[model samples]
Target: MARKPGLLMAQLLNRFIWFDAALQKSLDIRGHGGVRRLESMCMVYVHAGIRRPSELARLLGVTRQSVNTALRELEAKGLVYLEPDPEDARCKLVHFAPEGAVMREEALDIVMALEAALEENLGRKAVDDLARLVSADWGEAPVIGKKGVGKAKERKKKSA
Candidate 1:
């Protein structure tokens, strides 16, 4: 199927990266240090309801170093902040600033455009069916992991 259509999953995914990179380029064609990749990626995670950098890395299938670079760029762009984790003093979490929220909203519009293009190319029903199939597979995975959403364990109760 892939060889026939020249659209293997990896190649298709590369196209998305290329598309995103171009979109980012058009957004601000300055340098590689622009407010595109990180903010764009952060918007995806935030839109998907995942804010933590740790979770973002896993969801994006990127390394922590890659995520860290993106986060730093986001910080420089005033799109995100690292707040001290109340639950764990030693840890920290990322949150969207007011401007970040605005950025996210704009990013969502861009995402919608991408989705519309995909639906148009793949056929709306096919995209919808693909979404359902992907969701079904995703539902089987637990939320927490060493590199995912982190440990979701409840606090231990005292013995009576």
Candidate 2:
């Protein structure tokens, strides 16, 4: 018997969803003050120096509107603030407020602890390998009407 083409991807996605849910619950219990998962992710990107709303949306693979909504929530919670970008008059940059900086540190510490737990569960070597695999460049994305579709048609013809 053969495994499905998307089996690995499906499994990884399912695990990530469950892991994110657990992480959210853990953060809530640790007094993170009811932040949503998207808000937390946006903060991480801001901490990583992605300041522009458009850039954050691109990095998170979400729409700019969604990022803006998350930013608004974070701002309401006193976790983030938006300031006019000096270089670009039309855009605003996202920044951590004083409280948000502290929250960012706590979030990072929690993430590190989770990584350590993963290492313990999967072994250091396996965890390292998985990290390497995930971080490696997989080349450009495939386009539906381009080479990918043509290749699929060719494969189908060959099989038929």
Candidate 3:
């Protein structure tokens, strides 16, 4: 019999949690200070050229309020600052402070080192395959409830 889908998903989630915890520990061991995991994730997005709060929220799959709260904490830590968006006065752009730039660079270096270690432990091909699988599009989401499925079936019957 084929493996259950739920089992596979659970394994994947477990690995994600393990990796997250390991990365946090690695950061702390490197004396990078106590940067929150969410803050580091947001910084990665910022470094990748996502500057707007709304855009970060979309990329991170979180609420704008959540992103704003993280940004505020980062700002208070002197890691990020908000400025008026030149294109849109009603919006603000998140930028790294001078100290934040240094910290970002160091964090990136540490992440790269950790990835290299993971590649070594897992084998380069296996690591690459896992990356590809996660990045692949699995298709649109399925309708969850019986009521939604019934509505879909009704629409299909009407069309037919």
Q: In candidate 2, which residue pairs get closer than 3 Å at backbone N, Cα or C atoms, i.e. clash?
A: none
Question: Where does candidate 2 stray beyond 4 Å?
Answer: 1-4, 146-160
Q: Per-candidate TM vs. native?
A: 0.65, 0.82, 0.77
Per-residue lDDT value at 60 in model 2: 87
Predicted model with the maximum lDDT:
2
Q: Write the per-residue lDDT of candidate 3 for residues 1-160, one digit (tens) a residue.
A: 6887769978887886676677678767766677776777788889889999999998888999989999999999899999999999999999998877766776777678877888999999988998899889977555545676457656677999
lDDT of 2 by residue, 1-160 (tens): 6787869889788877766776777778878768887887887788788999999999889999999999999999998999999999999999989976766777778778888998999899998998999889977654454565467666667999
Across residues 109-134, which tens digit of lDDT does each residue of candidate 1 receive? 66678778889998999989977865
Worst 10 residues of 3 by lDDT: 141-150
Model 2 — which ten-residue stretch has the worst lDDT? 141-150
Better of 1 and 2 by lDDT: 2
Q: Tell me the whole-model lDDT of each prediction, alpha carbons only.
A: 0.69, 0.84, 0.83
- Position 29, candidate 3: lDDT: 78
Best by TM-score: 2
lDDT of residue 135 for candidate 1: 63
- Give the poorly placed runs of model 1, Cα more than 4 Å off: 1-7, 29-33, 36-39, 138-160
